[model samples]
Target: MRVNQAALDVIPEARPPGRARPLAALRHRNYRLYWTGQCISVIGTWMQSVAQAWLVLELTDSAFLLGLVGAAQFAPILLFSLIGGVIADRVPKQRLIILTQSLMMVLALILGILVVTKTVRYEHVVVLAFLMGSLNAVDMPARQSFIIELVGKDDLMNGIALHASLFNAARVVGPALAGLLIARFGLAVCFLINAASYVPVVVQLLRIRLREPRPATGGAVWRDIAGGLRYIR
Candidate 1:
């Protein structure tokens, strides 16, 4: 089922004339655990986002270069989102997320080290952002679809809404916190903190007990992508 339809299936009947309990999705054990992990991880992610932008400006002092950084990061996503969704369907979501999150943490740490040691250059930031974008192209679709696995059909919409709330909250807090840290210490600390933040999520993924999914078969990879598009359409 499409994730939206999956969630709608579980949606409680629109209020029986009583105050609604919007946070009802948190009642699910898996979703609660996943939500908690994401709350921490996304905050770190935003910190990294802000720090990266600032680092780019510091290195090059050009708005055009900053735009290039943004484009480079998203170009892969623009090209590969369809393929990413197909891959997410084929792979176990939690395992894929764990791998992607770990890779991101490592990338952040590498940049952190370079910044701290005073060896970082503009080229390094561009290269790293491109790497991050490539990972994100896969990571995002898997993540969005994985909510159903966490909360099932009964609380899918609530789970998705809560997830968005968590992300928005993190976006607000992360950038503010990163700004403070960047001003006081340096950009490297933001990156390091982001790296450390991934631990909770990785550990959480390990703790999750999910059944292995049956392998998907839909002709070749290109065919799978086309099928997903047709399904979405």
Candidate 2:
């Protein structure tokens, strides 16, 4: 995909100018539905992230502890993403995302209930963070790979760009909304709302009719990891 082909350095010259247009990728119904659902879900995800941070501060009140919590959330991604990528290659991407998203929704609901009932402990927050991060490790790679299936090679570049734009827009706006909601209704409401936001994405996932994917050919996680490294070398 020639994203920002005009950028300085490397590869082919810029598109002879005026080739790019706005929202060209939205023409595909599947991409549109997927993108819209993802937008809603991503915004809610950001909201929960902000609310979770606030909850951590309230519970611990230490910047170091807060940093530790953040690290705990991403540690799984750092440690498991390579193996997760191998797992993604062996499963249907849509099915993988559906299962991971379901897990995430359940985790969010649990946290919300804990917070609302005044039973949330710091340990609970850390443990849930770790669990959610574990899901994200697998979900992230598959989600990226699945984009081409939605828009195909023709619109692949545009689809990828639009996805990034949606994510950044949500990141900017979601935190502000989270702050307001937390100020008024509190963290539990934010988590609960995020859980609800997953509904649209799940609905879209089920609506998608995927042809049978090619079976993944590989044996053993370590062998796959070694093959990946050898390819890089």
Candidate 3:
């Protein structure tokens, strides 16, 4: 028996030829879900970031203090990201991300509530900024590593490139939207919206089922760090 020529040609045409290579990572179902959630979550994150800066300036009226808020928000990443990487290696990335993201959502809600009730203080903002930064220090490394689990090794580079594109795109849109939201509704709404955005991420993360094996746990924390550094070198 011979196969029909028309039936054979359908296989090649099954996928649209115009599909862009950059979006190849999105072919994986887990990556599609993860990327969609990140799209919403990162935009919300950037919106909160812009709103936070504006709120600090409004509360303190000091350029020095505004700079301080920026420093507080990122200082943890500078100080503890190596520790975060070690932690990410030692535990499951999915659970770590869910924990960090949930905590961040709570922090955003707390800040929103403070602002809405007219009880917000510059001190509150500073402390919350530091806490959010601490969470990100852990969340970032796990997130970066988890792309491999989502898309696997074949599309790993594509997955990373797509993730960077999402971050950059969010950087542009989120701040502009924040400015508009602040001008019209006020800063509290930005924080509240950001908190709401995390809902989809947590829900999607819960839905993701990874086939990859969990990373093996190692001995001393310092030893793991040194081994990682040696491998990098």
TM-score of 3: 0.89
Clashes of each: 1, 0, 0
Global lDDT of each model? 0.86, 0.85, 0.88
TM-score of each: 0.89, 0.89, 0.89
* Regions of model 2 farther than 4 Å from truth: 1-18, 230-233
Give per-residue lDDT, candidate 1, residue 186: 85
Q: How far is candidate 2 from the true structure (C-alpha RMSD, Å)?
A: 7.1
Q: What is candidate 3's lDDT per residue for 121-230, written digit by digit as tens?
A: 99999999999999999999999998887776767888999999999999999999999999999999999999999999999898777644556676899888787789
Error of 3 at 113 (Å): 0.4
Residue-level lDDT of model 2, residues 1-233, one tens digit each, is: 65532121112223456677567677666677788889889999999999999999999999898898899999999888888889889999989999999889999999999999999999999999999999999999889888877766666888899999999999998999999988898889999999988989988887766556888886988999788778869
Evaluate residue 140 in candidate 2 and report its C-alpha lDDT on the 0 to 100 scale: 95
Model 1 TM-score on a 0 to 1 scale = 0.89
Query: lDDT tens string, model 1, 1-66?
Result: 435443443345554565656997886666777888888889999999999999999999999999
